[model samples]
Target: MRADRLVSLVLLLRQHGRLSATALARELEVSTRTVLRDIEALSAAGVPVYAERGRHGGFVLLPGFRTELTGLNPDEALALLVAGSRRGAQAFGLGSALASAMLKVVDALPESYRATAAGAAERLLIDPETDLLSRRLAAEEVPDAIAAEVLRAVFAGHKLRIHYAAAADASPEWRTVDPIGLVTVRDRGYLLATRSGADRTYRLSRILAAEELPEPAQRPDRVDLDRAWQERSTRFRSGGDQVTVLLRLDPARREELAGTALAVHAEKRDTDGWLRMEASFQDGRHAVWALWQLGLAAEALDPPWLRTALHDRATALATRYGTPS
Candidate 1:
């Protein structure tokens, strides 16, 4: 761990040119005294690290010093190159940073593996603008200023004030929240925060504006964001108005039904070679809508309301098309 910390210290200086002990302590999650000790150790080990004494003075390396820390193998290099190609970083306003980091990684890689890894990464497409069906996959546009403020609050453990556009309201409402973390899933970004001690996840794209407050965040010193996100997801999936329907469907349509259903409680083959499934939906309307899409391949066996809705829809369609007009 000490070795890793020393390497990180060197890389930080290399990347930022110079940094005060306070800044280094904050970035390394250590203390100023620890940073000073590490600086002395680096100097003792002939790392060419020097300190300046002045109002703006800090630790810096000799002008021509660079670390030989490119320890990645071919596969690791390719994995990083592929990760750099993803569009998810754009949601957090790190697209340019990712590009610069990738260039540095490539430059540091062994010359024999660098070109091959980059060429392979280019051939593997991710989140393409247009898919085979000609459907476009687009990422939400988050304003640079808003994203910067959100990031500042998250990293500095400060509170944030945001003007959020709720779907039910016509105008955006201002709310002060303690940002726990920022998450980017696919091409969308979400800010996981707590308002009045209740957990909330806000889409970054829907945040019309944001401001980082000077007040420290009211949250646990250490947060398990992944577990918190999972708990919230479980609550959302189970808290909705859910309805279950029994259906007999063609075996070939099993995937279609499963894809549309919230959950499949049971599945078994009937005596007539049809697959019977008990599936849950968001509500009766959702069940009816999904069944309608299957047409003749699926039949709603129970929950007479769902069957009636499907029958009504089929009758209306037949009446309209069977007319002499």
Candidate 2:
């Protein structure tokens, strides 16, 4: 076990760059003395490991000391490659680099292991097209990256210089702002921030540029994201523009509702081995979608207007599916 630990220690130093004896001891669950002993053992075995004294010093491998990855068995090499490949690193502009590293690891394998790795590689398939699209999306290819960066800065409490295209404003305008956070609805992302002047939600897709200020000051600790989300949601639910609808859901439907963000607006009860729930939604749009998905499990609780609206929508859909009369 001690000998195996020595090998593991060497690998850690080689892979993770450097670590203090205390760090190594904690990782290996051994005493600092034991870590030193292992380092001596490694040195005795012609492994180049050394330590520096004082602050900013720790265990370091001699430059150019390489651990042979081919030392891994065929099964191990294949597993390593598969794991690396699964990280979608290629889509994130890291595929070639990872692929190169995998090649080096595979080259270190013995002939039998090489054959196994080859077989696994044949079975391993990287979905190039899907990964490309996913990577592109994640890398801010669709939305303006500068806008996203500004929003992120706001979330992080950093001040930003933003070139914005407002909904009402025509030309792009620049302003300095203290960002608050972002809200994502459906596929669109909105940046909720406070300009040096006021609170607003900027469409991330429309942001022209956002630059971080030097040594940006911290925002007030009073900004509570949960409180903001709740206030926004309440306004959406009770605002005169959007109709509030109540839903009476059965046990299965109630249980499902209890697991959502909207659960905050619901009241539940036990009813003869079943549960009854009342839920309020901000807009009929989402409510209607939920009703269509709930099938027969959910029923409208109140508001004659909502009932009529649902009936009319259902009838329209039914007529569309029915034979021409």
Q: Candidate 1's error at 34, in angstroms?
A: 44
lDDT string, candidate 1, 124-179, tens digits: 87678887899787888888788878988998999999999976365899999999
TM-score, one value per model: 0.66, 0.45
For candidate 2, lDDT tens digit of each residue in 1-325?
4754665677667555789999989777689999998999888989989988789799999987866632443323333543443333322222233433455565556646866876887896753434444653242222335643653576457787777777635788987777776655433456666665566567665667778776563467667776776776665556554444566666766655554424345555646544445555546675666666676776666667667777898899899989876
* Candidate 1 local lDDT, residue 184: 71
Count backbone clashes in candidate 1: 0
* lDDT (Cα atoms) of all candidates against the true structure: 0.81, 0.62
lDDT accuracy of residue 203 in candidate 1: 92
Candidate 1, residue 98: the lDDT equals 50
Specify the poorest-scoring 10-residue window by lDDT in model 2.
Answer: 88-97
Candidate 2 yields a Cα-based lDDT of: 0.62
In terms of TM-score, how similar is model 2 to the real structure? 0.45
Candidate 1: worst-modelled 10 consecutive residues by lDDT: 70-79
